[model samples]
Target chain A: MPRKSSRPTVATIARDLGISPATVSYALNDKPGVSAAMRARVLEHASAIGWTPHSGAQALRRGRSGNIGLVLVRDPEELSREPFYSAVTAGIEAATSAHGFELLIRFVRGGADDEVDVFRAWSHQRRVDGVVLLDLAKDDHRPPVLEALSLDFAVLGHYSGPEDFVKVTTAEPADAATVIDHLLERGYDGCLQLTGPFEYAHEGRRRELLARLCAERGIPHLHVPGTYTVDSGYRAFQAADTSLSARPAVVTSSDLIAVGALRAAAAQGVAIPRDLGLVSWDDSLIAEVTSPSITALSRRPFDMGRAAGDLLAQKIDGRIPGGSTIENSPAALIPRGSTARP
Target chain B: MPRKSSRPTVATIARDLGISPATVSYALNDKPGVSAAMRARVLEHASAIGWTPHSGAQALRRGRSGNIGLVLVRDPEELSREPFYSAVTAGIEAATSAHGFELLIRFVRGGADDEVDVFRAWSHQRRVDGVVLLDLAKDDHRPPVLEALSLDFAVLGHYSGPEDFVKVTTAEPADAATVIDHLLERGYDGCLQLTGPFEYAHEGRRRELLARLCAERGIPHLHVPGTYTVDSGYRAFQAADTSLSARPAVVTSSDLIAVGALRAAAAQGVAIPRDLGLVSWDDSLIAEVTSPSITALSRRPFDMGRAAGDLLAQKIDGRIPGGSTIENSPAALIPRGSTARP
Candidate 1:
């Protein structure tokens, strides 16, 4: 790992190659002045020396390309329905726009490795000053790669790994506990948790917390997998074995999932709050308009997004140190008709 | 407007200021070598002569920041709910990514003017090679401004009035006619069209088409406004006077609004199909998950997105001329329980 001060610069590369800094700059920037052969030689020497442009050269020192990079890695279909991202991205936008910075966003079709390549490519081209990381998975590959490249970044969401990056986490664990307590208080003997793909860091956190809490209270619970889409929620509901002695009150990861369950229940002639109770995460508009309006976790996504964006800005500006954890407004449970007592 | 060949170049600016091209490049790129006073004088001269760097200096010619710009100008809250953008953006991503281009996106809080400013800023900073314009309004302020700055761009969605730029339309007019024909065929005497704010070009087009069609057929039609959020949809549904004889069958621009109407009907004891019918646009997951799976216009937002993206890439690559229109797949009306004949 190279120390910050020791990172290769234009001057260093020029001296090593016995060339003027002007030639180095032209070759590095793909300017027309340098001959193709000389440019290749300069590039080869720079590569052998492990040279990468410092962020200061691209943004801080030169005031060039004031931008931040954010890459979204999700099925485009799923991304369209997930309100969480738009709100968070908006928050990031608000912060960046205020600072006169552009947010350079990209959507990668492939998984983590592809995402890593994107980060590398963007950084190499000096496209962004810093990046904001979202949905950090367990043993995520991003942080180490970003660290190696020495890119300023802030990780959004609860990632309890060893990466030193500015971090922000929504209160998913606490929110799950609140839902559990509410379900039990409503005299529900068993519970069903319908959640987004558990591979994501926060979903995993919620799953672990809820499962443990249910076990500790001696309450029977069933966990169902969903993709945070209406179709996935519908399928999860359709697939759940619902013939148990005590019907499980349902808790979902998103409003779309809950709505799917609600529609599935209607089709099955199961009555909400009579045969079952329901609670949804993210108090989005869908929760309000659902037939027996859903009880939901009011974890203001927009505000959380703003916090993440602001944190990234702070990290880039060097106002905050890496490994700093920002506690967002705690998630609050908003009780609605769907979770009404039997 | 300056023709392509007549556009200002580094050499042109250098000659105008009686300095070398290298000095001009250094002053413009904020590189050391040029004196601060000389740099200021060069910048002033360049600005006075409207000498913007050709895309070559930033991207096309030099391969600096292989990026494209896209600015979104919708309410953050509404953006999260509207699946249209995610699908379209994903399509754009697929194209840009395939061509090894990064997308620089930003969300602006204000309207068309704010969006115009974003385009100008991104262009002036050499942050993007070209831009992909979305949701262009009637008499949009963007194309003209973009033209004035000579920024390479492609407009997405329908903008009917007159700007000549690479264009794509979502077959919305034909889709509106299809929905109208379906409603009449299903024995619906009157129709209520629920839509996003009419100020948006597409929504306005839908509003005008439905109104004209209904008027011609002597069918009463009402256009209720919404912001594409579930709550707004709910309010629109509630505020819509349903007491008229031959109670209007609901046709919503988005599934969110249709779902909101469905829930409102359920709460009001207004049985769907028996008392009223419904149809939704976009054919999103919500349309399928609603109690009576909503009849919808399957426009394939993903494919539409891909088309927009491909078109932009072509324009940027100079494979297509400006003002070229790409016709999206014609909208297909998918019949579901919600619009069953009374």
Candidate 2:
């Protein structure tokens, strides 16, 4: 890079060299006609002022667009508030900067039919090198469509092996089991599980994972519908069997829900980790901001972003082996005040 | 438009009408003939049953790539987890579908210098008609670059001049002033402004608005320098002046910062509104979800994204008149208890 300058402008450099601004522009752009000495003076002054030519001008010759698209389900519009996704992007951007890509993030919101159409439209337009899919639904039609097209892409969530697709996801089922195993060991028996809408593929897996863990532990449990919303969690708490005989320890699918549960519990005169042992997936800043920190499946958003990027990079380079499964990031449960020894 | 389908798939239609799947496909796709009456019946039945040829097949023959690139500011090797960004995308998909544009979002994180090179690479490779930009820096170099290369693109934030860029921003400066005016009329006097990093144009304008508001009011004020990070907000509060006169009744800026301010205030035993009033931007779920609910200036992420789509659509249609800017949405103050009357 040219020698760093805090406040360098083209005019400043021109004034310093006693030349017209046009001459400075010509010299800086390297269009020539200035004496080599004048060019040297201009270069020295430009470096002193941080007046490098615009990146766009340089890009025309270097052959790159500083744009990358980050795709997600239920884009920012539909959400009342959710923190995990932003955490993931923060991580992705950290790595993107190291590699020099500008993330042009967007969302696709609607039912499954709309999702398929939206995915294909983005792919056909050649707006992004590869698209990243998250919150994959059961029997995701995306894999089939991608398979049938000349598109490059990757997934950031897991799916059953069928639609030969590239992906980066978490072993959410296993992680949920681990949290349950710990909860069971802590002597928390009856549970109310809060989760996102059932349409998501991972929701089923998370349910199954808990059921499997319950079966192995020989414990009978109750299942409740969840919308991964604070209101939902509050309602879940309201409907939960908090009776002394079958008091339920809550395990939420997300931190936001857990926070809501905590609030509801507090409203109901219940103490955290005492009346409820809450745990959520995708630990984000929310986990930290809550009154009682959340016990969650701590997945680094940056690491996850990096993982997703790696998959896309592979596809973009045509090195990705054609198959359904791409890559999986392991989800690790983190114990906080929400889940503790009573 | 095709007719709504009750039994749209080949298997379903074949089962419903006692026709073979191959015959159904041939007729649905308008392949060289069965009887014209039979073709009409097949087409009518198929339409009624929601049967249509897959997009890949159609795009393949037309030489259309069934995708739209979403360039993100992330390393090529990242897994995304940002919920707000996703919601914005959901909005984009909403528009994309209406126009038959598929969504292909990616993370391209790189240095300012090398990022555009990637965009150029994607363009040279014949991938997309245009791209969307987010997380813009002040004096963004990309719009000029996009303009110079005669490329199709739109940004989430405004550029300085229309002669060289395409942007859809919320006009944060004016919006900030409105909120500041609201606070001042309430005898809130000057606010302790907490905001995102100043490098962001939005933040820059926000700060300028706040400074100007304070200057115009002749009220002393101070801002805790920070990024759009909760941790930064927390730290800023820790170091914030606790003097009685200097303590602000209204704390302003990003919801994330307001959250931090809330936490810090709680830690310091400062009562909400009574001791300190907090105002925030982004009316995200965070605003409502925050205890006592943060007063916010709502910026419609969906409308902003759609406006950006419209700009990009215009560019793709070759109607771009020098990087046009659309202040598509204005931030409106949503008063909540966080900034309740003292």
Q: Give the top-scoring candidate (TM-score).
A: 1
Model 1, runs deviating above 4 Å: A1-64, A196-199, A224-245, A256-271, B1-65, B194-199, B224-245, B256-271, B291-293
Over the stretch A1-342, how does candidate 1's per-residue lDDT look in tens digits? 111233356898889989999999999989998999999999999888767553333542353446788888877667766677767777788888777677777777678788898777655445566788887887777887887656678888878689567877777667778888988898777778898877788888888888899899888778888787777888999998665437578888888888889889988998898889889977875676566778999888777777777887777776787777888877888888887877
Tally clashing residue pairs in candidate 2: 104
Please tell me the TM-score of chain B in candidate 2 relative to the true structure's chain B. Answer: 0.74
Model 2 per-residue lDDT tens digits across residues A1-342: 011223245777778878899999888878868888888888887776546443333333332233345555553443525656665665555545445454555454555566566445444333334456677878777766655544555667657756556667677766777787878877787666777777778788877888777777766566676776777788887887666224456778777678778888989888777766777876865675565677788766567766676666555555667553534556677777777786
| Predicted model with the maximum DockQ | 1
Which residue pairs collide, candidate 1?
B56-B61, B165-B323
For each candidate, give its TM-score against the true structure. 0.77, 0.68
